[model samples]
Each structure stands twice: as structure tokens, then as C-alpha cells.
Target: MIKKAVIGVLCAGIALGIGIVIGHFGISSGPSWLKDVAKDVDESFIERFMAEVNTIQIQENLRELTDVPHMATTAGDEKTVQTMLRRWLDDDDGLDDAWREEYNVYLSFPDANNPNKVTVVDAANVVKHSIREKEKPYTDDQRDPDVVQPYAAYSPAGHVKGKLVYANQGKPSDYEELSKKVNLTGTIAITRYGGAGRGAKAINAAPYGVAGVLVYTDPQDINDGFMSDTNETYPHSWYLPPSGVERGSFNRDFGDLLTPYLAAKEETYRIPPENIVGIPPIPIQPIGFEDAYVLICALDGDAAPFAWQGAFNCTYNLGGPGFKPTSAFSNSDVKMDIYNQEVIKNSANVMGIIRGSVEPDRYVIYGNHRDSWVHGAIDPSSGTSVMLEITRVLGRMVKQGIWRPRRSIIFGSWGAEEFGLIGSAEYTEVISCSSFSLTLHGCSYTLEKQMFRLNKTY
Candidate 1:
């Protein structure tokens, strides 16, 4: 019985040894099997495509384009479009054919004979007062010299100067509170930048006979330091002039050159040249607190309600001095040459196509706006470069014959997006109207959906 048991044990030990050998070979060759899996997946093509996409060139392109003041209705915007076309579409190395298309869109600016230029009144008096009282001088140059002066696109021009009053946020509630606590009629109002659009604030102040308006960015509202409570880091010091900062007209309701809803309509609606709202009747501009401090200190009135105070590190005040008329002020007139004409011409939309063996008609379209405000680095170059790099990688895969998508892949770099989504919108509308088998808008959401579909099918 003992001998029979020993023989049985030896047989079990041999079986275990063979099992161990098989497991060792399988573990040692795992990576080789993975390679085969990759080959089955068209061999790391997707991975390479993604790696090429995450390049630095993309960011540089975007920054270069958006770094300037290219408002939609300016000659500078045309230059921006030309630059975008050259960078994305006019490539000598035949990777793809990308082009820009232009559409005649109506835009307007301030009319002549408008008293919309900002002027500093009683400057001599303010300066004299500052020096006599040993206070900080009211330096107009302290704010951004190149700051895009504030103006409603279609504002009727007029001029009046009244005692300046501080209205916080300029909201309806704030206006109600002002009505109770102080008289705003025949007063020029100054409001901080928050709560609503600058146009709304100006429009609300206009009904009260508030002659002129000055909007300013408060330090408390926009932080300067990293990890600060504010949404974005302050681009410049409070004392410096506001150059290249983003300033937009929020007077969409009153109708500006580019009306939001009208921009998307089928029948193009054009505002008459004479009636476009351009600048405030009274001159308006944004100033930093350093400049605002001089204006605020000159106030001769009751102490400002606590909630109406700013981050000037001083008590706020409502100009009063017993509500008695004390001083009159006037602004120097200036003229602005605003160009608003449509030059309709042929523009191109560049496209690259990769034919799919299985379903060539089904397409995955990818696009990014190539135009910039200035050197539009962050606004577009970043995304554009990314798209370009992605195209390059896919092109390489096709060249190597290593990868082929089941559905056709179409890549495009759009133009005139900064000028109210002109390029992309036109393309979508045209393709939709035509009998194209499949065309999709390359917006953010659509891109995500296309990616998901590609993953599932590929």
C-alpha cells in the first residue's frame, strides 16, 4: 500500500511541473501577445495620433493671433483673417487644402458729431486741489493708454456733465436704493464693472439724466495674484493703463453692429448706417482705481453708503455738499473715423479628406477657428495648432498604410469665427441646404459625439 501511494504522488508532481512550465511561457510572452493585439487595432496608430496632437506649436499659434485688438468691424480684423489663412491653409507642403470664405455682414460704429469722446473736466481744479491738500495727483495717464475706449455700438451722441455719483454695480436694485438715499437727476454717474453689461448700466443711468458714465475695474472684483479669489489673474498693475484688455459692448438688446440673434438668422438683417449705436452720448472710458481715486476724492457730498464702497482703501462718498449746485464741467470734443462697409469676395474653406474603405460617405469632421483678434494665441492658435498637428499625424498614418478608418475623416480649419462664426456657420448652412450625404457642425459637443462614434466603429 505504501509503494502504490508513492507512485501516485510522483505522477501528481509531474503534472504540476508541466503546468508551471506552461504558465512561465505565457507570462514571459505577454508583451508579444499585446503587440499582436495592437496589430489587430491597426498598430498603435491612434496612440501616435494623440501624442502628435499634444504639441506646443498649437498654443503658440493661438497666442499670436489673439494678442491684439481685432474688433470684428475693423480693418485689423481683415488682416487677422489673412494671417489665419496663410498659417492654416496656404501650406506649401500639400498636407491639406484649407481656405477662408468671406461673407458681407453689416457692422456699424459711432456717427460723426457725437460727443462720445471722454474728457477730464475741472482737471486744473482737481490737480490744484490734490496738490494743495497734499493728496495724490489725478493722473489721467495712470490708466491704460491703449484701452479700447468704451462706447455702445449704436448709441446716439449727446453731451452733458453733472455732479458725479457712485452707483455700485448699477443694477435695478442698486438704482432703487440710490433713488431713496440720494438724487441722481442731472448727475453724471460712475459705476464699477460688475453685475451687468456696461451698456445696461449706461442705459439705466441715462434715464436718470446721469450725463456721463465711467466704468472701472475694481481690485476687489478682479484679483492680481496667483490662487487669488478672483476669477483671473490681473494682467497688469492697477496703476498702469489698460492696454489689450478685453472690453466688449453688452448693448445687445438695444442693437449693436453684431446682434447675437440676428447673426444666426436666415435673411440677413442690416442696421441702417446712421442709426447704429456706437458710443455713449457722453464720453465713456474704463479707468483703473488709481485714476478713479482722483475722481472719487474730488466728490463734495455725503459719505457713501458702506455697500457702495470700493477697494480704494478709503471711505466712499456720495457727492452732495448739501445738494447745492457747486461746479460746472465740460469735455473737449474729438472726432472718430469709423469704417463700416462690407467687401464681398470669394473666400475658401480648406478641407482634407481620408477615404475609408468600408464607409467612405460617413465622415468625421473636425475643425477649429483659425482667425485671431490680434495674435489670438489663447483664443484660437492653441486649438488651431492642435488640429493641425492631429492632421499631420493622421496623414502620416495614411502614408504608412498602417491605419485606415472605417468612416471618412474630414479635417477643416475655419476662418472668421472671431467675426461672429462666419466661416463655420456658412459651411454648415451650405452643406445642410445642399444634398450632401453627411455633414456635421464641428462645434464642441459635435466633436465629442464624433469621437465617441469613431471609437465605437474603429
Candidate 2:
């Protein structure tokens, strides 16, 4: 009996192995009619549809969205969101009401009193001092100095000047080394751009009584040489236009920085008070190494470690005068207005649908975010524009009566994606939770019969 049981188990295992192998490599030997149907769908419809994709429109949309510094919780960002919604609606070409309507999801940040406000010092001075003599000349006419100011959004406006200290990448480890070797109390810290996010550096500086924080991209980080040949040096790609490469700011963190979700309300969805989690107290800004070099050269402290060496073709140092008494340096108090107002409580998602003749309920949805950080051409507009072109082509196909899909298609252009994936996530949850029946064809003999009967009656 035991032998028989062991043999039975072996046979069951063999059967399971066979099933796995077949599932991985098996080709369906079903009806020839199904193959013919699939072939027709590909050749007659999908081929023609694919040919209509417009690359030009995709590039144009990407360039426009990423062209500016549109931070969340700002007027510029709101305008950008509305502009995308309007453009998608206008471009729908008569199929305006084919899908469900749109809605908005609100995201809140800290108010002025919150500690997240970053202080700025010598803003004009840095721009003026670094532009002509210290900074490299712009090779392209398209590069705008006004727009290129390296300031983070939500930064509290202020100006303070103190003795500057080179803090390497301004990471935790860099600070640990500074604490051990040198005293950095009551002084401004200048850091370079690589390690972690820029906000992390600013947050670190606040407790150290750091009057201000300055971040910049070193020459070794961005390029090998101080300046590159005009045409070859710029980071342009065919997939991107002249201004397509995004020189974006680094200020992203989980949850709303202005409001801290407590243990009880962590999962709850609601905007907290402004100035909850955002970095305030000290001012922070990022700059190019050219600007950083001018400040570093003026430092009167000990030389920095070998690891802190920059690509400046010079020895890296901490400061010249060494550790100074805390009383020697003075802190300048700066101030700025933090703007916070709950404006319009409405935003929308643009959606279009193409109904299926055989199975009208089974949906295949395609979507992309319409809102951008700036012009947002590449990050999302490239994909959004392509989706739009596909919609246009599919509409034309339907008009000609040459194509009839088996599954319904829903297209969406989402808003406020940069702030968070609020629009898409909310829409999905609402649709999924709502009671809506979907009819699917070619599911099984019994299911297909029911679907076909329902379609016939309707």
C-alpha cells in the first residue's frame, strides 16, 4: 500500500511538471476562425492606426510643459494644470461626452510659519557676482539666465551673509567629518549637488545654526571640461528639442511637507496645516560650480580632505582661519512672505472612449499625465500627445467603418500628476468601487453565449 501511495505521488508531480512546461511553451491549436480574426485586427486596423502617430506633436508638447519652474502649490502650477485640461477637451473632436466626467484632488503644503521655508541670501548678489566673470558664458542664445536661477520652491524669502564653509556634498557623512575635524557653528555652509536630494541638505543645515545653504553642480559632475564646444557640449537629444533636457530642481518627499500625518490619521486623506513638515528657518539655494568657486576661494579655514576635491583644477580645502569662536560670527535674520490660499476647488480629468461592437463593456484604458513640472514636454506631454494622436486616428477609422474592435478602449489625460498621482489614483478607486457591469466576449463558450445574447437584445 505504501509503495502504491508513493507511486501515486510521483505520478501527480510528473503531471504538474508537464502542465507547467506546456503553459510556458504551448501554442493554441484552437479554431482557424479565431486566428483569422486576430490577423484581420492586426493588418486592417492596427497597422493603419499605428501609421498615424505624430512625433512632431509629441516633441512640441514635451518642450512646452518643461520650459519653466512650475512648482506644486504655486500659481504657475495651477495655470499649467488648467491649460492641459482645456487643451485636451478642445482637441477631442466632437466625441466630447463619450466617457465619464472629470474631477480634482487637492494637495496641501506648509504655510509661512512652517519650518520648511528656505532662506535666500544675496540672491541678486549671487546672480550678479556669478554671471559674467566667475560663471561660464552661455553658448546658446536659448539659455535664459533669469529662468536659470537655482532656487527651490517653498523656500522662504530672505537674505543673510556670513562666513562660508565648504561642506562637500552636504550629506550626513560630510557633516560627521566636519564635526570631528572642525567646528561649524553659526556659519553658512556651501555644498555641492551630488549626494542626496537638495532638501535633505537644507534640513541638515537648519539645526547647525547654518545661516544659509548653497548647493551647486560641480564641473566633474555635469561635464568633463569647464566649457564644451557649442554644438557638442549641450545635453540635447533628438528625442528632446533644443531646450528639452530638464534642469529640474530636487525637492520631492513623501506625504505633504506642510502637514505631518499623525499615528491616528496617517491613512486619512486630508490637507494638514501649512508649515507642518516643510523646511524653514534657514534659506537654501543651488548654483553652478562657477558661483561656488568664488565663495570657496574666499574661505579662510583649513584645507578640505582629499575626498572633497572638486574638478576645479585646484586643491580642495575646508577654510583658512581654522576653528573660530562662536562669538566671532554673527547671524543675519532674513524674512519673506509665504503665500497660501485655497483657490478653486475644481480640476478635471480628460477622457475619451471608443465603443466595441462585439463586446462593448470590456475596457482597455490608455492614459498619460497632462500636467507638467514646467513645459513638461518630455516627462508626460510626449506620451500625452501621442495618446491624443492615437485617439484622432481611431476616430477616423471608426468613421470609415473599416475597423470594429472586440474590446472597448478608454483614453485619459490626467491632471496634477507632478504634485502626486492624485487624479489617476482617485479616478481608478472611484471607478473600481462603483457597481458597473462589464460584458466580455470570447471568454468561454458559456460566457460568450451570454454576452452575445445580451448584445443582441440591446
Candidate 3:
């Protein structure tokens, strides 16, 4: 009885002590913030953050970034790279650390001197009609010498002339259906965008013996039948202009095209040129729907399947080997003179870090690309503008000794994203992936790789 009474008294005393401590420190919950903590930070933090974000700064950044065409590995891309480095490495307000990592990666570009041409030509080599190499000079943006002509990146440079055929979407199934009706051999396929990937449009045609491919963005798909009316397009509304040519990478693979499984570096194992696959075997080019309409209306054959019909008012047809007898271009063959060349160039990824106050080793990656098909104002420069603005505000806070993140924040201004996501791919291959806790991207480029990770082929 004495032992029990003494034990109960001691337990009561211990409980009372714990209660006093709880009252004094308010220490009931999960583990505390595991560092030299800021005081009562939650109350005003969000308000302060919102106030710090400046719209003018973001706009200025956007304008500067979109001033030129910064295709991956080009001079404009280097300018953007330097811009990122300068912003991130500012002494007064900057990241805790900043650096650039470079990799030599393979890329393809159309010749600036001899532009790729898609034209209607007679057997006598007289040109009946030619699609313009570029969009109508809507503004100085289109006329700039740096403006890359509309050509499928990674398409082989060559000249191929064949009878024109209307192949809808260019999917394997689409081709399979078309093959049942006519021979696809030695045909120049004119396919509209929207069913399969840009590369698959040409890659799917190779098995059926297609000679060349011309891809176009249709009015129904992109403009909602807004052709012949200037009032319904850009500057007037959100519709695409009739001359809008959607250029894109025509490759089924991502990462460095040269180094598949390895990090692209000064010295890495590059697959032999002959070994590369998942790209167009024949030359491919992109044209505006205006050009598409001209070529498509000329074709004469069985009326195209109802499923194959697009927004164009004319009765669509599979080719009867050439143009209709009524058409001015009746005997003219469609020729693609493409001069795309593959080059190995250096691309750099600009990286910045904010060391975590608590767990410096762990990271939360925030990234945006710096390269684009054109100026990329919407796709990346806008996203880049926001990214830079975030870093500026956060960096200012860190510099002023006001706040620090719990997990290290790494900002990536990725390069060569326009060319198969080479920069980020090499970064992942070189870095320790186990250290990454999360990654936030402004655009999605990791879809196929993710698909492959799950054992599903892209």
C-alpha cells in the first residue's frame, strides 16, 4: 500500500510538470520547424510575398526575353542564357549560388541561304506555283533574318517530287486505311495536323513507301473556319491567321539525340548516325493551310472518305496521281527541296540555388526553358518572365535576411528544350536523381520518358 501511494504521487507530480511546460511553451503538436526559426512568420508572410511580386518587372523581363528568336544553341539563346546568369548572380539581390553547365548535343536546322521549298512543278521543271518559304510579313517579327523558316526539325534535307495525296492526320491507322484504296508508293503526302505526333506523320508514311511529307495546320483545327476574313484572326481575336504554320520537332524521341542512355558531355558515347531512329526517314516540311488548300484542291481521285474530310469547302479527294484536269496545276508534281542539316552544338543550362535553412541537401526544383521555335512569348518567355520574377523576390528576401526555404530551391533556366529537351535530360543523367524531392516545370517535356519508365513504348 505504501509503495502504490508513493508511485501515484510521483506520477501526479510528473503530470503537473508536463502541464506547466505545455502552458509555458505551447508545445503540443508535430515536430517543430527544425532550424533557427523565424518568429511568428505565418501571419504576414503571404501578404508580404504578394506585395513583393511586381508585374512591371515581369513584363520587362518578358519583352527583353522575346526580343529575338532564341532557338536552342543559337546566338539569341546565348543572350538569354547570359540574361539568366546576370539576374541570378547579382550581388545585391541574388541566389545563394549560381552556375552554368554545358553539354554538346546534336541539333538540326534548315539552311539560311537556301530555304526549303514546297512547290508545284511540271515534268519540264517549270514551277507552276510555290508556297512561300515564310509567313506573310505581318510585322517585323516575320521579316527578321533570324526568323527560322517553317520546316520540321530533325527532318532529313533532300529533294523529293511525287504525286500529291491527301492523307488525313498521317496516323498508322490512317495510312492503313488509305493504302487499301490506293498505292502510297512514290507519293508526296499532304497531311493535316491533329491526329498523331508531328514525327509520326512522316514515320508512319515510310512503311507504305511515301517519298516526302508536307504537314499543315488546318483552318477547322486551328482557326475554326476563319479563313478569308482578316477580322476573325489575331489582333482581332484569338484565332490563328491563315498563314500560321505550326513548326515543331519531328522526332519520336527525347533527350540528347546523340547520347541516348548516357549524359551528354564533352566525351560521351554517341549512337552512330545510322543507328538513330524514331525520326522522319524522308524529308518533311510544314506549310500554312493556304498552301495546303492549293495543293489539296488540285488532287483528283475518288472523293475522300467522309471521315477524312476537313473544314475546306471543296470535295476532298485521294490523289488520282496528279492534279485535276480542270486545275491549272494538272500535271505539276509536288516537290520538296529541304536542306535541313544536323549539327553538334554546345547548350548550357543556367542553374541557381537557395540553400535551405533546415534541410539544405534536399531540393525542390523549379524550371522553365529558354529556347523556342520563334520568340516563344507565350510558351516559354512568359513562363521565363514569371520564373525570373519569383527568383528576384525570393532572392531579395534572402539577401535582406528576411526568409529562407525549408528545402533548397533550385531554379533552372533549361536550354535546348526546343531540341529534344537535351539540357534537362543531361542534367538528370549527371546529377543524383535520388536527391530530388519534387520538380515543377512550366511546360511538359518528360511525357514520353515517363511513359517509357512504365514499360510503355512511346
Candidate 4:
């Protein structure tokens, strides 16, 4: 908690402080009031060097990092990590040494073909409902079919047909109510995405022999009204647009499933298929509320309990046996064509050091993830820009021999975070296994008495 709080303050302070510096000096051009304020502190050299940490530079950095989809285990992601390394190595920054620590990570994700799909048909064999299986963006970089599709990572790839079952949030209690009305043996669990992590919905349903799981975010959950209809979404406001799918991993264990509790080293033993934990065996896919509406209205059964209601226009029904299976199989079918390939690939973790003076052994680490599902302008590119600006200012201070710290600081830019916390978890595992602790006088890159350390990974 202390570390988190300290880093939060540091990030906020660095951005705000630089903005103030630019406003009072660069933009205002040292107005009479600014000159008067500078007189009190005599205008330190660090203040004069504040040009490196301006808003323009920050935006430029953000633009560069968010230019492409840098999903974990992709070439785009590698490009982003290398870009940061180049910045650190440039002579202008005046840093000591920078290197990328690589780790072998296993990842599961959809491909360029948009492999996942869902369809709903009625007993008459008429396609009553179906999703376009796509996203519509209000701005550039927000929507790209080339990006990973709206499917849960680690979902087993297959196709299944069954009756639709509206299980509310798909929690245990919701399932208990579902059991009262129907048997889940050959059902497709359709639940609104809420009340828990999106992945949990599929996990909870899998044990009941559910054929498949479909999760979608209802607009009413946004701000009490739908986007565009009542308020702006994306590019205009932060609210998700109709086609926005909240993409995320469903790894219940919360880390790399294959190599838990240990660094994913080349020699580390890997988990077998059956032993792999925290991932569901059933196919799972996420969709926008627009697509969900079609299936929700097609459902025909008892209206769900009052507490199970959502913002949908029709009553939420625990849909059923679907016209008694017209011929052989039920006409109500839910199908998924998921393609999540897993491979052992290397991820780069960039660690840039700034040696400390008095308490060199003890460390303060500043860290953030670099990988994103798409052009992650908000999730990480924004945070990455802040980290870069902070590094620029701190490097300038170190070069000018000003504002040294008593304790060593490490700046960490973690990679492969989207596929679970792969980079940091691997680093932490290595540290734990080696029983490694920061050396009191490891090596000083800045100065002998006072040091300012910075490290980053993505």
C-alpha cells in the first residue's frame, strides 16, 4: 500500500509539476509575476531544464507508443519495447546503462480472422437473432478488425448448439435459480457482463456442462442511459460505444497459467494440458449490448426474478428447451468458432537504473505495463507517456547533479501485461527463486552520495 501510494503521488506530482513549470516559464515567457516567484528559489538549474518535460513531448511519446496494436507476444509489442530502449540509450538523456530482460511467456488470443462468432435461431429454423461479430469505433485507433476479436482469452475452441439460458450474472445463486427451471446439460449460458469479472461468468457455467457462454455489457450500466441515444461515447466521452467490447483475460489464477509461482524460464517445467489451472474448457465470447439485445428478446420462458432484471427493453427470461428440439437437436443454437493459439515467445522487460547515494540497497520501483488489446491510448499509452516524461525530468536532474535521492529508485516498464501479468510476474519469480535482494552498494550510475534510479518495461 505504501509503495502504491508513493508511486501514485510521484506520477501525479511529476505531470502537474511539469505543467506548472511550462505554464509559468515557457508559455508565459516569464511574466512579471513568474519572475517574482522565481526570485524566491533563485530559479534552480533543474527548472531551466524543464523544457524536456513539456506537454508536446508527452503527446508525441503517446502517439508513438499507441501507433499500432501492441498486444502481448506480438511483433508490434516488441517494437514498442525497443523504442523505449532507444530513448534511454540516447546520449541526450544522460543515463548510465539500459538493458531488456527477456522471458519466455505463453499467451492465448484471437487472430486477424476474427475467429469467434455467435448466432441465435428460432424453432422455425429462421435466424431470429445474430451478432455481426464486430466493433464500430467513433474514432481512429479505437476500432480495427485486425485487432484481436471479442473473445475471452484461453477459451477452448469449438462449436456448440443448445437452448439459451439467461442466468443473470451467472453467479452461483443465479445458477441455483436456473436449476429450478431447467437443466444446464445442453444449455448456452447468456448473461449480462456485470457483478463480477467477465471471465467468471463462463467459469461458473462450465461446471454445469454448459455448451457455451456469451457475455455482453448492457448500456444501462454505463451512466443510467445508453450512449449516443442519451450521451456521447468514445472520442467525445469515455463511455463505451455500442460496439465496444471490454476485452480481457479470463485466467482465474490471475497470472501466467502455464508457469505459475515460478519464472517462465526455458528450463522451468511447464504445466500439462489437464493440470493447467484457472482457464475454462468451454468456448466463451463477449459481445456488445447491441448484439446481446437480439438474443435477449428471442428468449422465450419465465421472466427472470426481479433482481435478475437488466436494462434490456424486454423482460429478462430464463430461456428454455426451445420448441422441443424441432427434429433432433434444439433449434435454439449458440455457436463459437474461437482460435486462440498458444506459443512460447520471449517478452522484453526494460530496466533502467539510477544509482542511489545513502541507502542504495533499499529500492523504490516505478512500474507500468506496456502491452494493450488495441491502440491502448488510455489503458497504458497514457500512463506510459507519464512514465516517459518522469524519466526525462529525472534524467535531466541527474545530468545536472541536482535533486538526488537517499534511496535508490528503479523505473520498470513491464511487457506482456495483457496476457496476464507475465513480465512482472516472471521478474518477481526470478527474484524470489534466486533470493535476490538489492545490494547496498551495487553500482552507482548517477553519483556517489545521492542517486535517482528509474526502470521501465512494457
TM-score winner = 3
Residue-level lDDT of model 1, residues 1-458, one tens digit each, is: 99999999999999999999988886665554455334455446656666656445554544555545544535545555665545444333223344444444443333333323443445342322110101122334223222234444334445554556777777777777776766887676667888966666777776666655666666566643122213333332333222212344434332224333343233566545445452344444444455455556556566777777766655666655122133232221111222212333233344555665555566677766554433444455555555555665666666667666766676655555543455565565553522334445332222321222244311
Model 2 Cα lDDT, one tens digit per residue, 315-429: 5667532222332222221222233223223444556666666556666766665555444444565565555555666666666676656666666665555544544654554
Off by over 4 Å in 3: 1-43, 432-458
Best-to-worst order by TM-score is 3, 4, 1, 2
What TM-score fits each model?
Answer: 0.60, 0.59, 0.87, 0.79
How good is model 2 by TM-score? 0.59
51 Cα displacement, candidate 3 (Å): 1.3
lDDT of 1 at 237: 36
Give each model's whole-structure lDDT.
Answer: 0.50, 0.51, 0.83, 0.71
RMSD of model 4 against the true structure: 15.1
- CA lDDT, candidate 1, residue 173: 74
Best by lDDT: 3
Q: Which stretches of candidate 1 lie over 4 Å from their true place?
A: 1-43, 54-56, 59-76, 87-97, 108-116, 123-156, 224-245, 253-284, 321-375, 395-458
Q: Which stretches of candidate 4 lie over 4 Å from their true place?
A: 1-52, 122-128, 140-145, 227-231, 321-331, 432-437, 440-458
State which candidate, 2 or 3, has the greater TM-score: 3
Q: Kindly report which residue pairs in candidate 3 clash with one another.
A: none
What's model 4's lDDT at 51? 50
